[model samples]
Target: MHTAEELLKLQPVVMKQLQMIFEKDRVGHAYIFEGGKGTGTEEMMLFFVQLLLCENPKNNVPCGTCRSCQRIKSGNHPNFHQVYPEGQFIKVDAIEKLLNEMSKTGLEAGRKIYVIHSAERLNVKSANTLLKFLEEPEGIVTAIFVTQNINAILPTIRSRCQHIKFREIQRDVMVKTLVDSGITQSMAATVSMMTSDLEEAFSLAKDDAFALSRKTVLKLVEATFKNVHEAMLVVHEDWLPLFKEREQVEMALDLLLFAFRDIVAVKANPEAMCTYPDLVPTWKDAALHTTFNKLSAQLQAILNARKQLQSNMNKTLMMEQLMLNLQEGKSFV
Candidate 1:
């Protein structure tokens, strides 16, 4: 369980806003917490809920030992309600039931809070039904809509609530968290740049396959700058074998993109932080030989390959084309 103070590091602005709202005793009836995953939107939501439900809060922070805090922590809070997508969509039936519950008296005395996770998954019917409830909130109620993709949510629903955007967790914080968990600094630096999720970062940090993928990406980069033929050999001999799945191929492309980015960063400033800092000497040499325009083109090629890969393009062909693009600083596709 993360204390409000501990969560402050993850989202200072959001936390301060919530604390002010509580301090002024002006908590809104509805809100939309929007941000990417691992940005602490959910954690802030839980913290805010605890603030509202906790019978005894010190400095507007929930005491974790309190009954309300423990119940909320254990997912057994009576007044706290949560709605999730049943599968692919949050259908009308689930919204109807939740609305029905909201209409009645609360299970406890004070404010009743309902949080809808993956708000983008709400179908038209469910969205409209929820929109009606947002239109005229009854009793002491607060509705929080949480979504990674805010644009997917209905504009009408969005307009009804205060929107709080969560920033991506800082890289240094992520790196420290990973390093404290026993991940090597080099691997932590690379993994931290790849994702903001602590759980996913930890899993990848411990994964041998992920380590090998990083090595493969570096090898491909080296081969590309040396000789096109050699790069193609690396692809056929190594990349294709390791990144057989579409997701893995996409990850490989991301890694390749980062390697080029490191070179560009080195070109701009010799002391710049790098995803692959251990290869700074090689990156500096490549930087000395390349221009910004070439680096930009290489990055675009990698991005274009990623986009094409999502379109169900042939993975092997796409990678081959990408290698040629990176080698020549021009696209052949």
Candidate 2:
């Protein structure tokens, strides 16, 4: 269980609202915490649950030493239930089991709080089953549904819950958090732009494989102007082999876009911040060798390749074609 102070620090406005709700004893039976991944929604939910179950909460803050708090912290709170998706979807059986558990008396003398993560993954049958429970809440129950995609949830389910939107962490804050976590500034800036989630961006920055992939993209860019054959070789040997999955390929393409953007930045404004500040020397060299028009055209080509990738084209062939286009500086338009 996280401290209320920490939650407030992470999201002051949202937490303050929740604190007000708790302070006024206006806590609702159902709430929907909506936010993207890495927005601290899960952590905030856990903290709120602890606040609800804490025996001695002061100013809506959980006393960390209480037995109830200890049980929550240890993940053995009898009244606290959490439901996660099974495979791709939360099936009916899971909801039924949770409803059964919630229907019974609370093990402790307080509210029975159940958090459903990825609530959007509830299948139709399961959502209907949950709707019944929501329609007739029993035994001081509080239901919290957490989801990244609010639209994916049933409208009926959404209607019964109070929606609390969690905003994405600011880019500068995310970068600073990553830097504080020991990631290099250049990598942190790049990864933070790629994802809003502080933890995910930090993880990506520290991933050796992703780091190598970015370097390989830079290498391919360098090879394209000097030696087309070498660029093709990079695609076959390094790019294709390294990015076997579609998602990895998409990330690699994103890195390539970053590299080109850095090249453009080097030519247009040397003082401008770059996603790859550490590679400014290399970017300068590339910028000197290529014209602004060519770089712009190449950026378009990369975007076109991304579109082709989404069309479910053959991955290997699509990448091969993309490499060839980049080597030739061919504009898709």
Candidate 3:
């Protein structure tokens, strides 16, 4: 039960939004929470849901002792429904059920809220059904649709809902929270620069999984220019970690991207840049030139592969191919 301020950084503007909703009581039935992926938009939506469903709710928070709050905390809240992707997208059938539920008088009255997380994944038929509910929503039905990209959503659905922008909760805010929660100052700073990505922040703070994976990435990279058995051992040690978190997967990809960038930098100026900057002296000028073009294509391939992940593709195969592409241009010395 972290404070929204701690979780979402308690930015003045976003706080003002809650105040505005409470003051005027004009909060729309449907709200579109939009922001960068991995920025805790889902967490923010959950917090808001808690506040609304809490029985003895104060200005912006729910009194945890209340019956409503207890049910929500216990995952037994009757009125509050959370719908999300089943596999890769929310189908039309799922949307229909919610629409039918909302069309009723009110399951429990005061406010019946539905959190449709990642609404962007909703298909065409599903979206149209949602639009109908938006057109003439029942008295107390409140729907919150979340997405990383609003432009990709149907314009009809977009127009009906109140769009709430969830921005990058400032790195300073995220860093301070992490430090308060027992993370060290140096590690907090490192994760923040990597992006206000929540998964990355968590991975950086909890070293057991992520640090091991990073060690694997480094070993594999260094092995191509040094030792093979050691690299494979490193990869096996943290292989399970990669399957655990999407942020870790993304971070691993970032490492590959960084390696590609290093190759580019080496090509552009051999002495100026290297993937593992400390290892610049170990690299030969001829070697950097040899893999230069291959690095460029690999970078593009990684980007293309990242996009492919958004679709209903096979994750294991996609990631395997991606890792293979990453190792393509370089030779094991």
Candidate 4:
């Protein structure tokens, strides 16, 4: 089986592209594997690289029995180099250094491959350095750029590479994956609405308190609100320096919307099923009605905050106010 087979299923187009690369032996020198997060683009790149380097390649997969496959599997493949953000952005010197590393003679494997997890993180200086390398890859060197936002790459870089668009795994595929991960079929269907990633599902599925808190609000159906402050604290103090505040806020709203959706559902029909079925009993009709206006206002507020963030607003204050409004009893706040 291909790498990431367990977590994601590819569309026919993507599979066809894989087969073409294997058969033609004309793997492009540069490629942009673009898709949403958890859609398995990164895993697909690694699998494809393995297929290219596999000595005893089979059915478009690298046969682990062979030495080449063994080396790649063991992370000892001399020809494979992956570069990612050591901090936040890929610096010019870092990429320059990676390019220099690629130029070296390798102990094994015919093709030298470099996988950049977030190609968008390349700052101007680093991007310019990469442009020079892409202008000329002298040998069987392949660079796979994985991105959720393909437009972030320069036009010069975009025009030079083969662009492969990847979509989300279908509902059925997501459900089956969740089931295989020991989730009941009903829960799988419920959580798949948010996302199908196993790691996410597992956490959400297990957190009954999180679900109830979300029902206290209305848009997203199963998102829990219990750990908002805690989660935000970690993101602010620990991850803010690493990931953009825009991303963290988006995640926060995702949780809020999901929770509020359950609140709406419970308000309208108490008997109806909710994403957080386990959290249903905690819901109160009075609370739901009182919170309705606040929920709508917060939706626009989060959107406005997101806009201000683009204009360089203070993220900590934006989040602090947003969370405070969301946490209070809908009427009193």
* Per-model TM values vs. the true structure: 0.81, 0.79, 0.62, 0.64
- Give candidate 4 regions above 4 Å deviation: 1-12, 196-198, 207-333
Root-mean-square deviation of each candidate, in angstroms? 3.5, 3.8, 8.4, 8.7
What are the per-model numbers of colliding residue pairs? 0, 0, 0, 9
- Per-residue lDDT for 58 in model 2? 87
lDDT of 4 by residue, 27-109 (tens): 88899999887677866776787788888887776676787777777877788888887688987778988888888765454
Worst 10 residues of 1 by lDDT: 1-10
* Alpha-carbon shift of residue 170 in model 4 (angstroms): 2.0
Query: Which residue pairs clash in candidate 4?
Result: 210-224, 214-259, 217-260, 218-260, 218-261, 219-260, 219-261, 220-257, 220-258
Predictions in order: lDDT: 0.88, 0.85, 0.67, 0.67
Rank by TM-score (best first) = 1, 2, 4, 3
Arranged by lDDT with the best first, the candidates are 1, 2, 3, 4
lDDT of 1 by residue, 246-318 (tens): 8898888899999999999999999999999889999999999999999999999999999999999998899
Tens-place lDDT digits, model 2, residues 1-333: 345655675677789988888899999989999998878899999888888889899877888779998998999999999999999999899999999888776366668899888999988889998887887877788999999988888898888999999998888777776787688888887887688877788788989987898788878877776776888888888888888888988988998898899999999988767888788898888888888888888899899989888888898888778777787788654
lDDT of 1 at 309: 90
Q: What TM-score does structure 4 among the candidates reach?
A: 0.64
Q: Where in model 3 is the C-alpha error above 4 Å? A: 8-11, 104-106, 208-333
Candidate with more favorable, higher TM-score: 3 or 4: 4
